[model samples]
Target: MSTILFHEIVFGPIHSRRLGVSLGMNLLPYDGKLCSFDCIYCECGFNKDFRTKTKLPDRENVRAALEDKLLSLRREGITPDVITFAGNGEPTMHPEFKGIIDDTIELRNRYFPDAKISVLTNGMHLNKPEVFEALQKIENPIVKLDSALDKTVRLLDRPNAPGYSVAKQVERYKRFKGDFILQTMFVRGRFEGKEIDNTTEEEISAWLELVRALNPREVMIYTIDRETPAKELEKVPVGDLQKIAARVEGLGIQTNVAG
Candidate 1:
């Protein structure tokens, strides 16, 4: 066992390859995990057998902790680029997600006036009015769309719900218009004996079409950075990743390849 490593409701001014030096707010339990997607490559480990009770800190506590951390870092003359909503699992799963984001925004403005607030979500709750409103307020609303194909997405993400469809995700994404950032993990791996790979030509083509339709502000292409739970997964080479990025850029959408 990896000891299920979350220290508190607020953890990390950790290095984020995409978001820069960021502060993380984990709305999920410090010990338990709750997410709609049991992603095979989740750094937090697969969504466990725990009940769906979300151990989210209250909105005021999130603000106070984040403000305190920001002020402390300011006293030390340290600057952070982004204040992010992320953690052991899908952040939108928190019942008071909208309130948390609102509190985080107010605190960010009070402390690190220049720092951007970001939310990394699985797009599970995008259709909800409150979730959408909160997301719209954040500076970086990065949503995950690992694959456009229904079956491929379910396999890679291991969605917990009965009717988790990629089309529904795409529909939900439509509400964001051009405000959202898109992230996709390109890899080949097997889960529960299902052959899964999103890096195939057909897969990429389908995904690109969706990207074009979404017209996202940014498209992030990243393969695994650390050891994933699955062993047989193959990393998409940087060159290949760049090749995909170029295609996205050609569509006039900003694209970043994780180096």
Candidate 2:
């Protein structure tokens, strides 16, 4: 299984294809993956494959570590573009998520006032009041909506929630009121002897309808950039991605494609 795990509360000032030079903060366990959705394209691999036997870092610890890292970066004269909430799993799953966002905002205001705070989420917990509010507090609340159809979502994201449905999630996304960034992963492959592809005409048509309905501020369309847990998966070509972007752009919504 190809997987990448961050073993610290503050992991990187790594260059993100979409978010720029980002400093990552992980609220999940440092030793293993703990996400609500077991995405085949997840860099952290499947949840069961990397089950954590560790506790989540508390709010204070996350604040402290982030501060220390920011201080270190300041001394080096390296300013990150964004402080990203993403790591081993669904960050909103952390109990102190709302409080942590508060602390992070204060810290960012103190250390890097120009920097933005972003959260990369699967949107599984958007129905939770705390999670929804916390996401709103961030500059980029990038939520994943890989496919707009129930069956495709089930096959692609494999969400842990038994009653996960695209219809319910679309309504949940509407709560953002076009304030959030809609992220979708485009890929095609076979998993567990089942063939799958979200770049198809049918998939794209359905997804475009969702985009039209939700009317997000931005749409981020991309393909697998790293080794995925599912061996048969393949990346959508940059040309194909650009074509999709054109369609999204036609909808009058800004679209960012990371091939």
The collision pairs in model 1 are none
RMSD of each: 1.7, 0.7
Report how far residue 41 has shifted in candidate 2, in Å: 1.1
Model 2 weakest 10-residue run by lDDT: 44-53
Q: Tens-digit lDDT track for model 1 on 84-127?
A: 88877888978888888888878778878899988888998887
Q: 1-259, model 2: which lDDT tens digit per residue?
A: 6679999999889999999999999999989988889998899988888886898999889989999999999999999999999999999999999999999999999999999999999898988899899899889999999998888888889999999999999999999999999999999999999999999999999999999999999999999999999999999999999999999999999999999
| CA deviation > 4 Å runs, candidate 2 | none
- Give the candidate number with the greatest TM-score: 2
Once fitted onto the true fold, the runs of candidate 1 whose alpha carbons sit more than 4 angstroms away are 1-4, 49-54
Best candidate, lDDT:
2
Local accuracy by lDDT, each model: 0.83, 0.93
